[model samples]
Structures are given as C-alpha cells and as structure tokens.
Target: MNVLSRLWTIAAERRNELVSGVSRKTNAVEAVEDLAAQLKDVDAAVVLIFASPHFDKDKLADALTQNFGATPVIGCTTAGEITPLGYETGTLTGVAFPRLHFRFSSRLITNLSRFSIDDGLRFCREFVSDFGETPGWNSLAILLTDGMCRQEEALLSAMEPGLAPIPILGGSAGDGLDFKQTFVLHEGKFHSDAALLTLLATNFRFTELRFDHFLPTEQRMVVTDADPGRRLVREINAEPAAVEYARAVGCSVDELSPFVFATRPTLVRVGGKYHVRAIQKVEPDDGLSFLCAIDEGLVMTVGQAQDIVAHLDREFTGLKAKHGQPTLVLGFDCMLRRLESELLKKYNAVSELLRQNRVIGFSTYGEQYHGMHVNQTFVGVAFFDPENEEETGGEREK
Candidate 1:
C-alpha cells in the first residue's frame, strides 16, 4: 500500500525569555529539546530541526538522543525557518512532517575526515545507484552537509557521476545569525563536522528540473588568477581586476563594489539563459577584483532583471494546479539571494510577491539540487498526491 507523508515544523529564537537567565546556549538547546519532545508524539519517520546561532550543539545533541532517536532527523542552522503558518526569525523553528506514512531512512557520514573527493563521489554514485534500483518507487535524495565543512563542493562533485540527473534537493544548514559555520541535525541531535543523507522512496513522480541563473555583465576578462575552491576571485583579463570592473560599471574603485554586485552583475550564458559568474571587486586604486573567475577573453553580458513575483507565483501556483496544493516546501536559498530579498521587502509589492512563496529553507553559502551548480536563488521541492487535487489550506511548512 502507498502511504502519504505528513509534515509539521516548530521553531524558537533566543529572546532572553526562552533562555531567561540561562546561557544563550542553554536556551537554544532547551528550545530544541522541547521541539524534539513535541515531534516525538507524532507518527513521523522524518524529524528535521534548524537551530539558532546561540544554540549549544552538545546539549542539542543530547536532547535529540533523549527522544525520537530513531526517526530520520536531519537539519542545520537557518537564516529563518518557514513554517506552514508564517515566517520565523532570530529563533529556532522546525518543520515536522509526521503522521502520514512514507518509506524513509537515514545515514550519517561522520568520517568526513576520511571523505575524499574521489571516495565521496563514489559513495554518492553508489547511494544513487542503490536508491535508483529500488523497485517501482519514485525516489529522490535529500542531502544536508556542514556549510563550514569545505568539502561540500567536492562531495557534490564526486556524487555528480552517479546523481548527475536525479535532481537532488537540499540546502546547506546555517546558524540564524552569521555565515560563519552551520551544521545539520540528525535523529533529533545536532551534527557538525558531519553530513546527513536522507533517501526518500515515495509513490509520487519526479519532475524535470530546468534552472539557469542571471546573465553576465559586460566586461571581457580572464581568470588570470583564481582560488576556485574558496569561491574567491583573483584577477580579471590579466589586469588588477578592479580596474576592469570600474571601467565596466563606471564605478570608482570602492569597498562597496562587492555589495553592489547583488544589483547589476555579469551573467554567463551557459545553454541559452544568463547566469551570474561573479561580482567585480573595487580596489583602493580604482582597480577591480572579481568574486568569480574571468579567464582572459571571456565574453560576458550584463544580466537583465526579471520580476520574480509573476514568475514565482506561477511556479507555486502551477504546482498547486497540477498537484492541487502542496503539503510541504523545502527551500534551499543562496545566501546572496537572501540578502537581495531583504531589498525586495522594502516595497509592499515586492514583499507580497516574495512572500507569496513562503518556502522554508536556510540560506546557504551554496545550494545543491539534482546535481548542478546554482547561486543567488531559491530551490525546492513540493510533495503532493498525484491523484489527489484537494487544496490543503491548513498545511504550512514545505
């Protein structure tokens, strides 16, 4: 018999009251424990938790160990966690999908120290191969990795061969406050220095994923120097980098060019659509440095802005049209885009347009989905009954 997956989420922030006179760390752990206990009473095979920056990982781990220790609990820190009802900020909130039944399982890769790029790739392929081989089950992979752990790209890279086309969906967990270091919570506990994998076998069908980022801005430059692994740009067109950028954007070399990138940046047309490669860095001498590589002679285009309200509304609406209303949404937003979204909120129209898609996801240093590179965007998946078209107005977290 095919079973349905029901989900719910709970969150808490360190508002001095939750912690009272206790340590900020203590309050976070307490919030997690309380949330965990609440989730335990439900019949969910999946338990995910996104804690706050002020949380105590050790205590949070103990709390998860105390209750609902068997369910597949996987999550990380978040800029904000989206619940079925509304958005939560500065506190820890969780989306718990329980009660409904679905085949689910979890595994943790604790030995990241031992996780080599080659080996990790092999593991991903193997994982996909094993999952793909499941009989008659439409399977998808939900992966969460330590954002601080430098191996995320390498890990995704390795898994590419195996998961190249499966459309893996997940986000890098972040602590609510900073881009410093974030982790994943598994089995009601916190996991840092580790990665969590959840392979879901569902009765629903997988959809085709087609995504492309912004177009490149004018400025032909080469990546004369680069630190690809670190996401740092070194040089452009064999110049100081900043100079070339200053010329392109007509901006005086300044510290804010990096910040200006969010609004007017270059795009690389990969297949047909434009995608952002990186931003130009303004130097003290009117020179520029780019955040992404600019190999010598690289042709670029200034990406045009496209209003997301209409696009996003249709995206979410179309899903509703096809699957009725989605029971859940799992968003993996790029940290850069989240910053841009803050700007979008200044206007009522933009705010409503953006919020129309209240996707619950943590801002990530980077995001992963079905095996491709994405930046400054929101990526997610919706769970709906293929045959059922009833609107779930009561459902909140996705």
Candidate 2:
C-alpha cells in the first residue's frame, strides 16, 4: 500500500496558499521533515497537525517546532487520522497556511480542571494585542484538549465572554480508544492535562461547518440522576440508565456496548438543533457514561440514523454554492462516526466522502462548534480565495 500520499492543496493567487501532506514514515522526525518539504517558498503563518498516537510526541513536537518555529505550530493526538485519500491510522498529516492571508497566535492552557474565565480573557486579550482589532477580518479559535479531562463544559463556558465575535472550532484529543494518555502541542513541547488555543485571523472568506447524521425519535428519557462533573448518568426516567437506553434501542442491557452506543446514539436538543450526546460506556452500576457533558433534568432522546452519504452531500453542496470554492477545510470528526459507519457497513462510503471533499483531520473524542462542545458531529472551517477560485466548487475544501 502507498503509505505516503500526495498533498491536497489550494492557492488564492498572492493572498494565501494551503498545502496538506501525509507521511507514513515510522520515525516522527522523518515523517514531519518529509511533510515539511512540500512547502518550499511560502513562509507559513500556521501549521495545523493531526497525528497518530504512535509517535513519541515530544520528539514530533520538537522536530516540527524546530522546522517551523517562526510560525505557530499546534496540533493534538488523534483516535484516527483523516487523510487526502481516506481514513487512516499511524500517520501524521498537516496543512500549512501562508502568512500573507493568515495570521496565527496561540496559548497553552494547563491544569484544565482549574481553567478559568480570567485565563480565557487573558488569552483573548493576548490575541487581540497580536493581531490588533480589524473591522472586516474573520477570526476562529481552534481548541484542542485532553479527551479524558472531562472539563470541556467548564473550559468552553469560561472562554465564551473573552472570545466573543471569534467563533470556536475544534476537538478533544484521543489516544486511539486506549483512553490512557493524550497530548497537545504548544510551541515546541507536548503537554498533557492541558488544552491549546490557536487563533486564526484572515482576510479570506471562511465558513464554519457543523453537521451530523442523526434524527431525533419520539422516544425520550429524562435524566433523573446524573453526575455532570463525571458525565455519568445514573438513571434515565428513574430507571437504570443503561437498561432504559437499551430498551429504547431495542437491545438487551447486556448488549449495550460501544458498538451499540455508536450505532444508536442519544441526542439532546441545543439551540433548537438536536446534537448527539453519545454514550461512552455502560458503567459498573449500569449507569451510562457520556462522551459529552450531561445533567440531571435534561431530556435525552434516542436518535435514528440518516443516510450518512446523503446528509454529507447536501451540506457540501450548500457550501460550494455559497463559498465559491473552498481553499482548505480543517475538519474535526467524532470517532463514533467511524464506528457507526463500520456497524452499518458503510465505512468505505464514509471514507470516500471525506476524500471526495478533501477533508483532512482526525476522528476525535468530541467536537466543538461555536461555543458548544458536542459529540458524533463533524465541525470544520472552509476557506475560500476569490482570485484563483474553482468555477465549479464542490463542497470539499483542501
């Protein structure tokens, strides 16, 4: 099999340039060095990395920082990587954006449990100080944190007031379902129990993308008992959470496993749209642990699967109609989607959709769109440059 593949790139004449590359080389240094070679002339403003957990993260971070220290280098470990061709494992993929069209700044947030609004405000202020206030510029914040922290809700909430006007888009890092350790890069070092914030301010047109393939059903259960801090639901409608959930999905309590949870996820309505609140596991107490935050009194409904390909196609179609042509799309996909596709025997079809759309990212533990931290969803940023645009814009960005 061809491990190293060609990059999917887009250029906006003299304004901005984006080039994405993937490397299957076993050595982290060689992999990144090979990927870096693809960008020759342009001085990158930021380099976004999505890498497998197989590498010594410190070495990878050090190597990438040494090579691209002048720019902001940020990324996180992933459950699985999305490349130009399709879904992959054990690979490091990245994209470099030229400085002319993009300006980048970042902060490494440590001790996620103690992450505060003050800290968020400080980070926002720092970003403003770097970029200055621009009236017509578009901005987005890329947030990556340890998947096991369970602090997304608190951290994201704190970040809201400070990051007004600049939307948030990102995902929680994963250790390939090992659930042991996950790493995020800041400058030239890798840190755990932390999060990295990358602020992107650009003159080019950018569209924020968030979509899912689950429709709510009539069945509903109220969270009578839950531990919001631990994201554990002890009871649903006053019954054992797993038991009630299994019954709703037409399965026995014993069959309430990861595969089942992925195939038949639960949804919670947020902002009038149903966002999936996926179950991570059936706890020892028969309680249900979720990938995202859940609270008592919250109503959860079972979700039915939609035609995954069709939903994706529709979203992409709409994007092209509006953006002209996407220069690059940085995606954050939930790992559960991969599992669900496998259960439905549509893994190939789903991978094809990612390739067809030139979506490069990783399957994450969870995703963030705007200010909301969610699960089983795909969130991304689609960039467009008018000067060298594609006339027949397909939904896929670079």
Candidate 3:
C-alpha cells in the first residue's frame, strides 16, 4: 500500500487519544516531517521512533530536532519495523503519547563497556526518584540499547533491583543484521555503546506480554569451552561448537547458518522455565556466537519449533478475552523469529496477526522481559481502555 493509504489505515485504527503513523519516504527530513504531520493533532508528551538503519544518522537527528523541537524524542535504528500495515522495511514508524494521559522521563547511558552493576543500580534509582510516582497512575519502563554492545545481561541485572515493582520491557537496537554497529537515539542524536531508558506513567490499564514458539527436547549439549565475556562458545560437548550443533540438528557443518540456527534454537533452563539462547553467527574458528549471555559449563538443549500461527492466535485471543481489545501493543520482536517464519512459510500469517492485534515497534536482535534479556521471543505492553480502568483493576503496581 502507498504511504498515505497506510497512514489513513493507522488513523482509522488509532484511539483519538493515542497517535501512530508510518512513513515510507526515504529522505530523512521528509520521513520526520511525515511523522510530524500525522502527530500534529495530538499534544504529545513524548514521541518514540523506530527507524530503518539505512537513514543517515546525523541527518535524521537534525531533522527530528527541527521538527519536534523540545518534545523529548527517543528512538533507535531497527532491523525491521512493525508498522500499521505490519512488517515493513526501509520505513520510519512511530507512536506519540499524548500528554493528558501519559507522562515520560528518560535517561541516556553512555560508555557501556565500563558500566558496572553498581553504576546501573545507582542510575536507575536516581531515574525512578526523579520520575517519582502518582497515586492513580501505572508505571513501566522501556529500554533501547545498542544491539552489538553485548551488555544487556549486566545492565538489566543491576537495574532490576533498583527499579523493582516497575515492570520493564524493551528491545536492542538493530542494524539490519549488519552486526558491525548499532545505535540508540536520545536527545536528538544517535550514540554507539549506549542505552536509553524511558520511564512512563499512564492512567490506562496495561499489562506485559511475552511468548515464544519453541519447546525443549531431551537432547542436550554442554559448553565445555567458551569466551563468556564475548558470548562465544568454542566447544560444545568437547567438539567444535558449530560442527557439533550441526550434527545434533542433522545438518552438515557447511549448512550451519543463521537460518539453521533460527530453525533449530538452543535453550537453557532458568527458574524452572526455558529461555532461548539464539545463535547470531558461526565464527571463523568454528565457534558459535550467541545473542544472549553464555558461559562455559552451561547446559543447552536443542529447541524444536512449534506451530507459530496457532501459538500466536491462542495468545492474542486469550489477551482479548481477558483484558478486552488492546488499543495498542508496543511490541519488541526478535528478528530471528521473523526469519524463522519465512523459513517455515508463515510470514504472511504472522504479519497478519500482528496487524490485527495492533502491534507497532521494531524487530530486535534481542528482547528484554523484566530483568531477563531473551531471544526468539515477543515482548510487549498492551494498553487497554482508560474508561474501563476501574473494571480492569486500576493502576497495576507491578
């Protein structure tokens, strides 16, 4: 569909109080202007943007500052965007929260390599203190970090304690599978080795959502050797990581690739639940690079893919039945999930579900659920009717 048609479709679906739009214009200035025009009617407290990495960062930043002028904009480059029309590429998609029902505050963390647990805890404490709290308002946080920084595990660990009781859901900024550089945009500019944490308070009823289409198998492997800091496994079951993994999945060493990894993911059990430890790439030395944390002696099982369409249908249906239809679902989806859907020939079905459910955000290298940085999963916040807040058990505390 054309850009205007897509915008009109979004307009028709949006709640008058919440604003969202997508722009296919390739020019950086035009893209921002298009978004600005769509959001013009809403007196937004903050605007969140998810953009294609192909845009020039400096130009995009300048245009955003000029167009939005002191409106507190925050966003990041995306692997791909989830638009009003569902999955899209080379597009700029955004959601503007009106000031009447929503209030926002943000902080930017730079130099992630030197960020310690203590630092993160302190930073989060200060942020929450400054944001304060309201008697009848519900609060949540959204984190956007450099996808390539490899620091999400540490950062989330530290901040969890300080921000306890305030739910968090987020995505790692992606560069279209480039793996070289990823950036987080805050305060009108993009920065590497950085993260943006935004605290939001709203009167609307909201709930956190998480789901993945994978089940663990009995077959397992041990990481006998690894570079824990870099999330690289050199040996699995005392054999070259890539070779052993390929054999386990019934594929030759030469056939090991991102697609293979996506189709056959590795899982680790934590707190009596399984979480995906997705493989990002096969290294030159036959090592396996993971998207989340990994360490020597960790036991990982080969995860089998389930029915993607049915799983999503069931989840969304349950959500609507329980909480009524969500006005908007701010989603953080893993890019690997998108790839696996294509591999399984379920891309269109998945996109249709996202569109029907009112999901808008970006595909990420990794996704954050509360304190955990997970992969091959969908994490989101579903906002429901403010008018029904009392019936929905007003103002969720956690």
TM-score of each: 0.76, 0.91, 0.94
Q: What is the C-alpha local distance difference test score of candidate 1? A: 0.55
Whichever of 2 and 3 has more lDDT, that candidate is 3
Steric clash pairs (candidate 3): none
TM for candidate 1 is 0.76
Q: After superposition, how far is residue 357 of candidate 1 from its true place, in Å?
A: 4.2
Number of backbone-clashing residue pairs for each candidate, in the order shown: 50, 0, 0
Tell me the RMSD of model 2 versus the true structure: 5.3
Give all candidates' CA lDDT scores: 0.55, 0.82, 0.90
Candidate 3, residue 78: how far the Cα is off, in Å:
0.4
Q: Between candidates 1 and 3, name the one with more favorable TM-score.
A: 3
Better of 1 and 2 by TM-score: 2
State which candidate has the highest lDDT: 3
On residues 143-261, what C-alpha lDDT tens digit does candidate 1 reach at each position? Answer: 78876665665566666565665457776666654557677777655667788877766544334233333445445445555555555444666666665555566665553543466
lDDT of 2 by residue, 199-236 (tens): 87776677789999888899998999999988999999
lDDT of 3 by residue, 1-398 (tens): 99999998766545337777999999999999998898877778999999999999999999999999978889999999999889888998999897767889999999997879998999999899999987678899999999988999998998788898898889999999787799998999999999999999998888899999899998899999999889999999999999999999999889887778887899999989999999988899999999999999999999998888899999999999888899899999999988888888899999999999999999999999988999999999998768753432345512
